[model samples]
Target: MSSQQQEKYEESELYRIRHSAAHIMAQAVMEMFEPGEAQIAIGPPIEDGFYYDFDLPRPLTPEDLVAIEKRMRQIIAGQHKFEKKAVSAEEAKAMFADQPYKIELIEGLETGGVDEYGEPLDEKPEISFYSHDAFTDLCRGPHVEHTGKINPSAIKLLHIAGAYWRGDEKRPMLQRIYGTAWKNKDELEAHLGRLEEAKKRDHRRLGKELDLFSVSPDVGSGLILWHPKGALVRHLAEEFCKDEHLANGYDFVYSPHIGRGQLWEKSGHLKWYQENMYSPLDIEGNEYYLKPMNCPFHIEIFKSRVRSYRDLPMRFAEWGTVYRYERSGVLHGLMRVRGFTQDDAHLFCREDQMPEEIDRVLDFCLHLLRGFGMNEFKAYLSTRDPQKSAGDTQRWDDATEALRAALDRVGLDYEVDEGGAAFYGPKIDLKMIDALGREWQLSTIQFDFNLPERFELIYIGEDGERRQPYMIHRALLGSMERFMGVLIEHYGGAFPLWLAPVQAIVIPIADRHIPYAEEVAARMEAAGLRVEVDARGDRMNAKIRDAQNQKIPFMLVVGDHEVENNVVAPRLRSEERLDALRVEDLIGRMQKDIEDRM
Candidate 1:
């Protein structure tokens, strides 16, 4: 598609609202500061919000946000008309004389207008500008017709942060203001409310409260310190993944954290993934690199043994932990980390086996996600970036067509990401929408024609000839850290009975009932449930509150009356169900829940 067509496609209703909101935000910032003091850099619309970078002597504060937001409301209330104008290169440069960023943008546009043959077109597309009242900005048109047409109550300032100009750290730092705009007042309110609830359910906050994990600045960024509780959860998740993979005919394998640099070279990772990889270290006169991906190692395992066609579809799975050098600024809590364990696997299959192997992986992925109680999903069929790709046309076509066929065969409707695939191959990414309506990328099934060819992977065909095998790389849980983050948010920290770090907490009202609480805990543990006894010398209400705060799914409150009747009061996290039940009966149900992995 043409660039203009791409722009048109990108401009959705929400995009227009956010784009117009950016202009309004810039106008607000300009008006809030003293007349010639405020210098604007760039204001762009992002997902669900608008942010503008600014150059100012004084750093903006919370109070400044309020003042600027107030001015924005005033502008919107004034109902100023937005006018669009087209001008020549000279006229555009003159209009943007004081705006360095705008001048740069216009110059780039002029250069783009030149033909490849070195002759500029006679009818060059004119530079466009949008004007609302006294504030004007160089922009492509398609904004709201009038400021008054916007819902005054539907826009809000979210936060302020420092960002480098054009995202380059070497450039001058600019203060960035973020805000969200919605179609209506109600939607805006709902969006803000969700944000607030999300904050309450943030895994980072819960991690601290529950003593789960922490990130220390002293330890460097993007490195996680998994506390005891967090480690227990991680262990459970990994075990669950291992069991699922085993049931799906996968052979478990272990690979080293670091491999010889030659291995990555053979797999083509050294060339394509060098930026994300750690610097190589020399060991005994040989250079070695930490593995960025587990695929190359698994492929080495496959190629170790000369395989007949019977072992063609060799499925190798591993909870391989690897490290990647993510941009420091992009790291946030455990969701984005430098070191993580990927539930990675690769199936070396013959050409004819690709479809069935992919189908099996998809089924296993669905079942695993369902086991974790994630039912809602969004699938993307990501194809090659046609403009910048290393593979030949035939291989790209074959890989992309294979993915298309799989999706079609399953009758799964997925959106196509025009150029979202990795440089190596086409892939399918599954993003699960949690109960909170947040999307998390959890599963990926990717095809790699480049790796097998680069590694010269081979399998004996039916005709007794050596032929290249197709490789499939799959990661059901993108990473343990991120998946745990999503799981915490999915269940709001009250994990399912089987997955909860502490499935049941036995609470004794007083010291007298502590013995009975121990008995109940023992019975629960015997039934294969994770149980803890709260024997603190605190009151019953305090203990109950503590359990609730920890988000324990069930709190078995034991007291004298319960001991007399040989029963316990089962209190749920929601406080909706508090019923007296026979201890054995509840134990039976808990055992069933654990056994079923529900």
Candidate 2:
């Protein structure tokens, strides 16, 4: 959003309504508990809704949420006018003496430090509190003028969960109540409907139901075990991507999984990224670490050979796997995994070639994503943070402009995230909107001034002098594991014909038809289709149901009639049945679907 748009939203009635709803929920919680029993913490309005944390005497239950919401409705009905008052630091501390969490916030405000929630206050400002009815708490005011302005039916208590104070494991866990407040009942209903749809498409549930992948206790958390079916889909995706990269002038390369500690030091990973890295192992007399990235090794490859300006644009691609330590609590299915393969590539180009190269790569990223059935895309340009970023000011400015120009040249809409760039360089991150309208960051094209300079990467120019080369890091699919997970959910496990592990299943009506089913499967397999034969001793309908459950694209049913006429009845996953067709016609149709990527 632009600054003007953001200002309009922050000043809108809906913003005030949500903010006040948070306070109302907090008030209801206090009334439910005995005085001093519920230590109120920070309650803030977030995107789309609000949440409040509390150090309560006990864990809240579903019944407790109902009661609290009921009390909030009553308070809203009372039409209490919100009142704000300024207070001195000493006075604020004394007023909230009974509330330990409030007292801590007050002290932090006074000292210009972080509060219990770890929200920083660079400088102490005037302390204030907002009150409505008999409830009062520490807060910054921009609330509704009166509770009557809020629609009671528009607010709902969503759910309850445990959250550690300040998001630190060492801190005490607090109960967090999440709620959504809308302007009216209709909007709330629409939001709830979307949530229901999202639940049905959740990747974790579909991953298990479709038997694509699993996280086993024996293999350790965040380490995914891709079953055979899942592996096949993944392999197809990789094959498609590799073919595209090769066609686009990328030279495929391979590197070891572990590297010497000095490699990371030269790459600056040790100083800036050690926290996410695992401890190094002592091999012989040297230290080796699991490679956390593929950039350093790619750089080593470039340095291994001296080249003139003719080799200025060197694009090296690899499906490199890396490991990083992710907290167990945050270990989601495939989204936040410890081990994964990145579709990583690096391009070494001259200064004059930077803009065109970036534009080409951006186009390639969009084309590749579209080929994977993801058509919606938007780019985010993250520029350097002055205080934290490395590299010279001129280089940073040039790189930022190059990224912006690439987006403009491609006629792509993008939002600029000022000061959000990594320490190394500016980047353009492409996000794909899934079927549920949820955005996933899938591709990133970054300029790396730090790495080239750190490694002293140079290329001989036409003038015979060695000049520094610009390095562009691009990851089109981001990671194979996460992209597969996204694909599974996006299609609800019903992949397109080309990507489906089992493109077709031949189901025999009776035991005597098994030979015919196998023959059909063999014919299909010979035509380059991944076909399976269901020879189990089950009824025809049961076999068809099992094939449907597996989400196979086509089910070719064969029996005495099919065997005699060289024809089979085809059933789609959508339960649409086609007229009996000759084997040659079926193959042609299936081939067309695969060619079209349907």
Question: Which has the greatest lDDT?
Answer: 2
Q: Model 1: per-residue lDDT, tens digit, 127-234?
A: 888999789988776788888777888999999999887677798998999999988999999988887897877888888988889988898788899998889988
**Candidate 2, 1-598: lDDT as tens digits:** 7765667767877889998999999999988889978898888887778899999998899999999999999999999999999999889989998988888788887885765466776666678999999889798768999998899999999999888876887988999999999999999999888888887777787788788889999989999999888999999999998999999999999999999999998788999899889999999989999988999999999999897899879999999999999888887778779999999999999989988898889889988888888866778999989888887888889989989988898788899999999988999998766545667788999988899899999999999999999999999999998898788877889999999999999998998988888888888889999999999998999999889988999999998888889899999999999999987899999999898888
- Per-candidate TM-scores read 0.86, 0.87
Q: How high is the CA lDDT of each candidate model?
A: 0.84, 0.89
As for candidate 1, its clashing pairs are none
How far residue 181's Cα lies from its native spot in candidate 2, in Å, is 4.5
C-alpha positional error of residue 157 in candidate 2 after TM-score superposition, expressed in Å: 3.0
Backbone clashes (count) for model 1? 0
- Residue range with the least summed lDDT across 10 consecutive positions in model 2: 112-121
- RMSD (Å) per prediction: 5.1, 4.1
Question: What's model 1's lDDT at 88?
Answer: 87
Pairs that collide in candidate 2 are none
